[model samples]
Target: MVATKGGDRVSGMIVETEAYRGPEDRASHAYGGRRTRRTETMYGIGGTAYVYFVYGMYYQFNVVTAVPEVPHAVLIRALQPVEGVELMRACRPGRPDVSLANGPGKLCTALAIDRSLDRADLLGDRVWIERGDRPVSAASIARGSRIGIAYAGEWARKPWRFWLKGNPFVSRRDGMPRHVRAGRKAGGGA
Candidate 1:
């Protein structure tokens, strides 16, 4: 519930999210309401974490938002992890104490988020994006293929992904190296 210069937690948590429509939204794991116990949270409003397990190892994080009951959300591909950082680290221990809140998987890991958080409101204190006043420009935002799932075909190519032009804590994809890549490589649906 602590708000920061970059809007509170979830505000920035949701600062950049990809809107994956129904099943047609090829990139959406919940496309077609593929309710499989893991994606059930996608059906709710914007404010909760839509967490799911992948590769039997990593945990992908998302923010559930939109009209209640309407399945939609913005995938939280990455984060700055300003709030509750020690707690975040408790959830994700690194090989050398590196940030565990940068990548989509790391975000969830750092936050200790899993499917159990599904349907939990973002407006609540346990988890939420505390929106900021400033607006991140679309021009400053970059577009590129979402990470790890290039095999999604056209879904893989759709550049619904987004992020601040340059923030050291944000995640990096194959298209761009964290420090050397020019411009930003957009991400996929939230």
Candidate 2:
């Protein structure tokens, strides 16, 4: 149930995600005492959207959840490209199919997600997670802190990683060896 890029309707599946608790969660951008016009979205009711531009080149998507003002969000790490392969690839070319949705910015590019859809209701026709029968085993999943933000300090060590257990599509940062990244995907039978 992956969302379509061309205003075509499709459901978005929750494949791989990472949770960042506000304030207490150091890995979160809305960490304690940090607030901005951009972060203002993070302060709003959970279930809202937190889309932002990065590198002036790509958009990173995040889903706000938990109590309003709690500032918790699950970074959509990756999507399996289950429903729309051709569409995803058209938006994101030059990579293996698996790599299409492997990273945050990459996922948006592949999924055709952008700032225009920011704050849009995910439960609506344009986007949503249709129930699926994917057998994501616990053994196939993995856990670890998130990537690209060493500034998180102690929060950097939190094991908030969730992936499709043993799924090879999870994006790994550069320079990190394979054996060191063993992760267990969670919540089987989505």
Candidate 3:
């Protein structure tokens, strides 16, 4: 959940995520320890928001994971609206409810996420994640490659993307048949 610029709260259940391992993952902004003004937040402690602008158009939201300096983060890909649905609709007018937060950019727009919230403490009042009302079983999660990183070479094929199986709100299908198994942890927000 996150508070908007107007102080209204918008919340959703995360249904899709993509993990980016630092230094090693070619798709990661922190790859090869390339620290800059924008990617510095990825080096922060876990639970920090590493929001960034991409393609000069959209702001993508990520949750820093692991201990400090790890630079591991999870990109929030899709969300299932749980609160402030009407307000979300107002922010993204004319879109169907299922499409409101079905992608990273759309999720950020629906929740009013932007660079201003970069490095924000997710555990703080402005933004925070909560346990979903119901548990998601391992068998219900599909694992596949991250999207829109074809230039990452071999790293583009890594099965770092996870989403709820058969969920209508998922932004796009990854075309993988594998499912997460019990006891296997999906790093950075499974």
Candidate 4:
């Protein structure tokens, strides 16, 4: 969940994620050990937010992972809305709840996340990850190639994307495994 300065709150279940290992992963913004002002937060300790703008418009949200200096982060690719659906609908009007936060940029827009959230502490009350009671079995997780980075060559093919199996809120459902798609068709549990 994330609370904005105006006190409006938006909450969701993180259903999709993509990993980026700085200095090693070509698709990462901090690739090749490059450390610019924009990527500095990515080098911070784990639990730090690394929000960045992309394509001159959309904001993509990521959480710094691993330890400091490692620059590892997990991109929050998709989210399932849990609270403040009306606020989210206002932000992204005309879209269904499932499609509101189904993509990285869409997730940010739905939650009002922008550059202002950069370097924000994910462990803080303003923007924290709460523990959910839902149990996710290892077998219920699916992995696939990261999206929108074919320029990274072989790195683009690495299966670094992970999502809950049969999750309707997952971004790019067409890219999911055959079994997952079948499960969704059969109305299997997410």
Residues 1-190 of candidate 3 have per-residue lDDT tens digits of 5555467778888999999999899999999999999999999999899999988889899999989988999999999898889999988999999999999999999988889889999878888898888888999999998889999999999999999998888887555333546678656343
Off by over 4 Å in 1: 1-17, 94-98, 173-190
TM-score to native of every candidate shown: 0.71, 0.82, 0.89, 0.89
Off by over 4 Å in 3: 174-190
Best by TM-score: 3
RMSD for each of the candidates? 6.9, 7.0, 7.9, 5.7
lDDT by residue for model 2 over 1-190, one digit each (tens)?
Answer: 3565567643334567888888777778888847887777777776666788889999988887867667888888777667677777778778888788877888888777788766666676555555677765677567776677778888777778776655656776322334343365544333
Which candidate would rank higher by TM-score, 1 or 2?
2
lDDT (Cα, tens digit) per residue for candidate 1, span 97-165: 335566766766666666666666667656656554566666767666666556567877787777666
User: Which candidate would rank higher by TM-score, 1 or 4?
Assistant: 4
Candidate 2 accuracy as lDDT: 0.71
Between candidates 3 and 4, which one is better according to lDDT?
3
lDDT of each: 0.61, 0.71, 0.88, 0.86
What is the alpha-carbon lDDT of model 4 when measured against the actual structure? 0.86
- Identify the leading candidate in terms of lDDT: 3
Query: In candidate 2, residue 138 scores what lDDT?
Result: 77
Worst 10 residues of 2 by lDDT: 173-182
Candidate 2 wrong stretches, greater than 4 Å = 7-13, 135-139, 173-190
Q: How accurate is candidate 3 locally (lDDT)?
A: 0.88
Cα RMSD, model 4 = 5.7
Kindly provide the TM-score of model 2 when superposed on the true structure, using C-alpha atoms: 0.82
lDDT of 4 by residue, 132-173 (tens): 668778898889999888888889999999998889999877
